[model samples]
Target chain A: MADTPPLLKTITIIGPGLIGSSILRRARQTGTLAQKLIAADCQEAVLHRVTALNIADETTTDLIAAAAQSDLVILCIPTGAIRAVAATILPHMKPGSILSDVASVRSSLGPEIHALLPEGVSYIPAHPMAGTEYSGPDAGFATLFEDRWTLLIPPPGTAPEAIALMEAFWHRCGARTRQMTDQYHDQVCAIVSHLPHLLAFTICNTADRLSADLQTDVLEYAASGFRDFTRIAASDPIMWRDIFLTNKDVLLATFKRFEEDAHRMVKAIQEDDSEAIMQNLQRGRHIRRGLMPEPQN
Target chain B: MADTPPLLKTITIIGPGLIGSSILRRARQTGTLAQKLIAADCQEAVLHRVTALNIADETTTDLIAAAAQSDLVILCIPTGAIRAVAATILPHMKPGSILSDVASVRSSLGPEIHALLPEGVSYIPAHPMAGTEYSGPDAGFATLFEDRWTLLIPPPGTAPEAIALMEAFWHRCGARTRQMTDQYHDQVCAIVSHLPHLLAFTICNTADRLSADLQTDVLEYAASGFRDFTRIAASDPIMWRDIFLTNKDVLLATFKRFEEDAHRMVKAIQEDDSEAIMQNLQRGRHIRRGLMPEPQN
Candidate 1:
């Protein structure tokens, strides 16, 4: 068998929070990136955690300085902050360096990032579909990416070598990599990720808004399946807000479909149409089969 | 302490499916039902599974005969079927035996159950806030209720001795039992379990109805929060359909609140209101903390 190729000569991760730290840890452990693993974070405590994890060879608050020293730069902060970080650091990076990111939605980011990429730098956009409700460096563990899928959404004219390098990095980090068009990726994520978060968060709030008497009962009776929503609803707020605002069109499109289906179920219940309600419920079981992470038998 | 009083002199479980068998397994392992533990199901295969698991002293297809022999009788079938079983077995049950059920909903049931109770018998309603999406006798396990809550909702005039025996049964099964009115149990579950299932089924159908082109992409993007909904959506159909139909008013009431929240979020996104969006997202974390299962830590 042919030997696997190294991901990069050196790696630089910007804003070493949960997502960034995972990439750094996995890359170093798998020897995916040779020479050095570098990271930059504005917050000192988070950086301290990242350094303690030893995923980064060096840490700096200066994005530009870090950008200059590494061959692969990963933008890992919230979506709203990516453009600002790019503006500050891109010019300091070497010309051939590859820039990728861990944004949830890709199309919403085009304008800000396009205007700031250093001339000649290859920007292969990525969204690693993995994370927990927790955040910061301490929230990360090496297995976060195990068996997860990561999409590398590259601009059409990007060189093969740059795409190859980014794909290799994600593969070593325990992700199954797939390439997708930016528009398709955003639309797909809207239905899958964005809508789920919005629904979970909104539903949890609806329960909490009930009278104090009802609130305690709601929590106690949460056995009716509200427990799962609580877990998803707990995800990072600043990050999700930016995701909703940025992916507005696609999210709205998916939410429209969700509301329509729910309205029908409500109608069926009101009319007491056992057949319709039963069919809808049964079909859910079939659809859910496709969605579960296959558990070990 | 006085030698632990036996929770059951003889216990009868009708309908040994997933929930039924789970209760039996827990009862036998915990020695909750002291003298005898019996089970009845239509399917002989299910009977054998129960016998093999040894959660039952004997298994039969005769509901009335089984009820005739027990000190405590539990109707462990789905809701729509529970009323029929109650009617058939109530007349034959021992006169002073306490009758109860593990149905997820209660208010809609009290009137029917109260009227059907055979003379000189007590009817108590209870629900264990626990289950897996999986079903069938083979799916039964002893620890399903380990940290879940079991709410016992009986009419105001219920005999304390009867309530105590039922509570002891659940407690021995490893559940923390709380008492509530039938109306309160119905309302809380509607918001937490029924509404969420409605949302899951609706969203799953909506996503499934997406044009053939986007369906594969939807599953591809399934790793994002979408997987959570898929898990809930995959639950048993007959059970959920009854939930929606039986708990319609409360589910509808809760739906209005959820609809408003969804509208606000979509509007915030369309208008690009970062402040409104973040505030809404932040509310989820608050609910998540309160919703954690108390003994999990």
Candidate 2:
């Protein structure tokens, strides 16, 4: 692996937050993505921290300057900000450079930005299914994407070389990669990721509204199941808000389906129909068991 | 701690599944509950396994025989079956002995059973706020309850000695104990534990209804959030069904509130109201951070 050449001459990552800094750290640690790693963020304080961490060969708050010298520019900011950031940096990107992003939602953002890319540049959207509840530069780790999946949504007619390079880059950073359409990615993620986060947020709000005395007990006695939701619900508010807003149609569609299923169980419980309740619960357990991956190292 | 007297001479745990086995193992490991640890289950194979593990000083298929010799009897079966099991064993419980249970729901079950205990015998109810998704006897460990909270719901005017013994017993099992009424335990657990599990089950079912290809993607791309739900959804079906059935009223009440809150978010998303969505997500994060316990060892 070490004998293989670095995939790019230089790669700049904009927005040195959880996902951005993780990419910086992992790419540098592996020495496979770029010969020179540059970090860029809107906030100077974040850039200062990036410089101190030494995960990047250079750090700048100027996205355009950072993009000028790089073969690849990764926009790792919120979904809502991706287009603005991409437009600002695209003018400075050299011809033949690849522009990519790590936004959670893609259907709206990916195609819109891909169509706006200059003729000589390529755009591919990637979503690494990895994170914790925490954010910011310090929250990142080199192994954040280890044993996780990274979805690559390349625009149609994209060159094979660009696709291969993106695939190899994520693989070097410890993620398995899959290719799909941006529309399909949004639909699939709405069910798997977006709906789940929405439910967790709603559930937390549900507990939040408990009568003051009961509220105390709810927090004090939260067990494993609720604790897990709390961790997910505790994720970055603005990131999730942007995700929901960008993927609104698909999310609302999936949530409608989820609410129907949830209400079915509620009705079963209300009627004291143990058979229906048991059957629904059994189906859930069966599906989850079948989907259980072999234990990862 | 080692020099302290055992809380009771003999303690019998009926239906030695996950919680029951953990209690037996932890109590015996600490030597603070009973000198003679008795295990009772309907399955002879489970008894054989328990005997081999030596977690119990004696293993019995006969609940009556186990209860006849013990100063304390704990029913650890499903919520629906607890009353039946209690009736059978209460006939054999010695005078002045305490009858207790580890059922999750309390307002309905605990008081009803506590009222039926034989004269001169005591009844104390407990709900241990600890568990993993796994079940069965071998799935248990002595540390399952470590750093967890256990709620003790003693009936009004109950003997202080019985309360003290139960408190010390759970403490020996590595839990801190808090006292509350049975009615209140149901309300608290309904919001925190029961509602979360129901939502997880429903979310899993929602994914189960997806097209076969998308279902595969849901499993493959289940990032930390959905993955957490899958683990909770994979919990024992029979156990969860019983909990939902027994705690139906409180659970339905909580679920109604949750559905209302969820729909509010759904409307906000559908309308592209970013501020409302962001506000709800932020509130969830704030509540979770405030309630996080000191890091467990």
Candidate 3:
């Protein structure tokens, strides 16, 4: 049997942060993602750390130069910075080359980036549905994407071959891949990821605003539920800030839905309506249980 | 050196559910909580399970009989049913015997239960800040209370000796005990436990109410944030319902605070106020990081 060739000749990953570094580590370990892996970040400190880690064939602050030499360039920056960074690097990307990103939100990103895409370069945005509260290059691991989903959201009129290659690329990095339009992606992500994060962040502030004594006690006696919320709340502020602003419409709609449901719960409790409260609680529990994977014998 | 006597000569646990069975298991394992451990439940099946598990010295379905022979009787039932069960068993409790409960809510319970207290019988209510999403006798373990807080809320003018003995009892069960007023306990719990559970339950229902396709995708791609909320939402519905209704005022107040904070977040995102969003996210991250225990070498 003939050996399968490497996925790409050279791939440059911009912004070597948590997700970027994890992908680089995975590519270096597998030795099949690309023959040459380039790590590019505007920050000298990040490049220094990338060099020290030795996960990339080359580390550079010159994203344009790296883009000019690569068959694929994945932007691992914040959602707010994707367009500006794409515009700066797209002109140098070769024709038929692929440009993708790992931004969490995808509301207007598709059309905005498509407007800036070079004539023959393909832009296929992807979101790897895996992360931790911790960030930065030092916090990444090779298997961070294992068994996780990487949703592909390509703009309209993009080449099918580019999307297929990106899917195969993510699969090689140990992630399941699915393709969906940007609108659906934002809506699903709003309920599943964005809204939960907003609630986590808001609840932490609420707890922090309590009286000094109560706040101290709340921290000292933080229960499992509160601790879980706090752990989610500890994610990177700038990254989350960008996500919230980019997916504002869907996120706000979801929050309104959650708020109405919460008010219903409050009314049930206030009216001493045990049956209504029980029904709502049961529905929540049932829905949650249904989401669980079946246990294997 | 003399051997230390048991905390109680005979102690009965009603309900024999998660917390109750855990206490029984710990008592059986340590042989110091009580000289004779009795498990009583209205359901014969629960008592049968307790017997089968061999965590209790005696198992019975007769609450009155169990109370009549015990020096200490702890009601490990739902908050809404605590008063009625205490009223039923209080009449049969021996004189000078201590009666306590492990209800999650404390609002108005201290006064109400104190009103039904027979002469010379003490009532102390405690809220153990340890539990899982699971319930029932089969979902318990001996070390469930280890290093967890059990806040004791005794009625005004209660005997100090009774309070001391109950505190010691919980200590032997491997829980740290603290005494506080019912009002304070309710307030602390509203933020630390009840409010978080309320949010978790409400968010699950909100996601359930989404469009069919979106709902399916939300569950299929449930990320860490949503999964955490679901884990919390999967808790016993009946137990949570009773807690919400019992602590109605405090829980509702906390929910209001949380709603206001959430609205503020929505406004920040709507106005595209990155500074405000960044500040709130940073505050949440800072508060959450502060709650983490220091790393030991």
Candidate 4:
């Protein structure tokens, strides 16, 4: 890679949490940024952690001040907090700055954030469908985005150049960016990420109270496939709670589909239909074969 | 480590398939046998794979004669096939040789297999909780058992020394052994292994006809946790069919519990109860945290 070009203008991150700090780390590492890298977080601990990683060149505890001095302000926070933070930071934004966010539950906040943004400031919504079970600045790594897809939910009328620049940035961050409608993004995520998390969380909680002997045996025999679900269910509780709360409708829809499908199998088993059992098992095999290659950890 | 003592004495293997061949591979690697090592399969091709892997010094189509010549005759076949195989092999077994069978669904098979054994042959049931999505001799590897658990189930009046010897052999083959009653083994596995496989199979199968665009999204987002399920669902269909067929009652019971749990959560989401959702997710986190210290793979 060639040396990074000097900053044309500064980029300010609204919350230098895990994904936020990691984005800074990757931007600098990939030589995509031309000027300054600044981070603004309400928590001093977050500032310290980001600075300690040397991913940010400057830091502050004020979102407005950070927005006033930047060409781009990236909101990287919880789904529940995106709207309030955007409202606070919107007034202080300079004209022509491209403001964007990295939140998973896009549809819930997209319109609200769009409504609050000052004229001439772009609200380009993006969600990187990539993460590990860990969180926080210390847990973030430059390579988290490698080979993962970042869905960009740019509002219908957002300028082409603003969307293109964001796509270029994601590409440099090592993620393949796919432009998507806000509705499509939300529904797809509900099936692919949200509902799966709910299932993992539900099963884990249920199995936890079984006899100690059975519990140990459950974990031991988990090599059969349950262990993978266990790994996801192990993710930070608060982040997931916020996700389930915010993406309620889409997740509920997917869960309904899952329940109907689960019931059919249960009925088949009760009746001892070997053909039904074999058909279901074979179908699972095909999907397993169809799912894309996973990134080697 | 000291050189292996070649403790095996006329070891015999019945139904020399994937697990059989794998056990043979690692057993030879550790030099665990005291004398001759023999493997037999009703299928000529299976015996050929055994000889090619060199786990068998000799192979035969006659399972009974193979049983008569050995100190230990391992029934390395499906959960459903063990009883029939044992019925034929036990009749020709020589007195005093310990017999053990490797079948994942233990509780249901234990009594049946024990009843069929010859008067003098000691019967110890065992299941090595290790395998890949792949099967057959080409998939066999000596390291498959490395850091894996091999569970042993012994009937009443079985000599302790006989169990100890087999345990030691598995340890040498790079596996840890756990002794448990047949009933408990089946109950634990129904939730941890069987239910998970059925679930994975169903999810994969139902989503197979997903639109091209949805399919792409599924693959792209799989690293979020879905691919692990895919790998499990990819396991041999024939073997899984045998497991569900033989362990119908236990699996039915397990499926009921899973449905009750899944249905409760689906209702919680439909009702939009934050408290219920949060509780389930947090419980999942707790259970998953407990599983972290164990060897997941």
Displacement of residue B1 (Cα, Å) in model 1 is: 14
Interface RMSD value for candidate 1, one decimal?
A: 2.1
Which 10-residue span in candidate 3 chain B carries the lowest summed lDDT? B288-297
Looking at candidate 4, what is the lDDT of residue B260? 78
Clashes of each: 1, 0, 0, 9
User: Candidate 1 chain B: worst 10 consecutive residues by lDDT?
Assistant: B288-297
Judging by TM-score against the true structure, name the best candidate: 2
Q: B282, model 3: CA deviation in Å? A: 1.7
* Candidate 1 structure quality by residue, lDDT tens digits, B135-232: 77777788988888888988777789889988888888888998988888888888878888889888888887888778877876686477778888
Give lDDT tens digits, candidate 4, residues A16-83: 76788788888667656647889889999889888877888888997888888888888888777888
For model 3 the local lDDT of residue A256 reads 84
Candidate 4 regions exceeding 4 Å error are: A4-8, A292-297, B293-297
Candidate 1 ranges with C-alpha deviation above 4 Å? A1-6, A292-297, B1-6, B292-297
* lDDT scores of the candidates, listed in order: 0.81, 0.87, 0.90, 0.77
- Model 2 TM-score is 0.97
Return the TM-score for candidate 1, rounded to 2 decimals. 0.94
Better of 1 and 2 by DockQ: 2
Predictions ranked by DockQ, top down? 3, 2, 1, 4
Native-referenced Cα lDDT, model 1: 0.81
lDDT of candidate 3 over A40-114, digit per residue (tens) = 999998988899999999999999999999999999999889899999999889999999999999988899889
